[model samples]
Target: MRRSKNRGFGIALGVAIGTSVGVAVNQVAVSIAIGIVVGLIFGSILDKRSQQQEK
Candidate 1:
């Protein structure tokens, strides 16, 4: 399946960061949650920027 351009960066980055933190702290779930939230913030910012560029 094709990846989504809008969300791909944030999600990938989030997961990577999250997994790293989680593994380091031994709190997989919490780390993943934090990562996902951060990723969503990043994704939203990116998406808004892209939309602005298109206009």
Candidate 2:
């Protein structure tokens, strides 16, 4: 449960950062979409790391 929550937080943080950076770079739509994708990828990576740690 704690691990899941942490993963969720990580994902949200990634998305927020990615979107903000994208917007700052002036690539609005494309940046947002890319940000979302990258966020998901990063979230999954974090999840994997957490799982490995648990074991």
Candidate 3:
């Protein structure tokens, strides 16, 4: 449950950051897509680490 929440938060945070960067670079769509991918990767890594720590 907590892991899911973290993943969601990461994605949301990515969106926000991506939007800002996109606006600066004039590539909103591409930035958002990249952001989502990066967020997912980071989120999954975090989840894995958390799970490991729980053991």
Per-model TM against the reference: 0.78, 0.62, 0.83
Q: How high a TM-score does candidate 2 get? A: 0.62
Residue-level lDDT tens digits of model 3 in 3-47: 888798788878888989999999999889988987888789889
User: 20-52, model 1: which lDDT tens digit per residue?
Assistant: 999999999998888888888888888888778
**What's the lDDT for residue 24 in model 2?**
86
Q: Write the per-residue lDDT of candidate 2 for residues 1-55, one digit (tens) a residue.
A: 7656755676677677777887788877776676566766776788788789989
Worst 10 residues of 3 by lDDT: 34-43
**What's the candidate order when arranged by decreasing TM-score?**
3, 1, 2
Where is the poorest 10-residue window by lDDT in model 1?
1-10
Q: In each prediction, how many residue pairs overlap at the backbone (N, C-alpha, C within less than 3 A)?
A: 0, 0, 0
Model 3 alpha-carbon miss at residue 31, Å: 1.1
* lDDT values, one for every candidate: 0.82, 0.72, 0.87
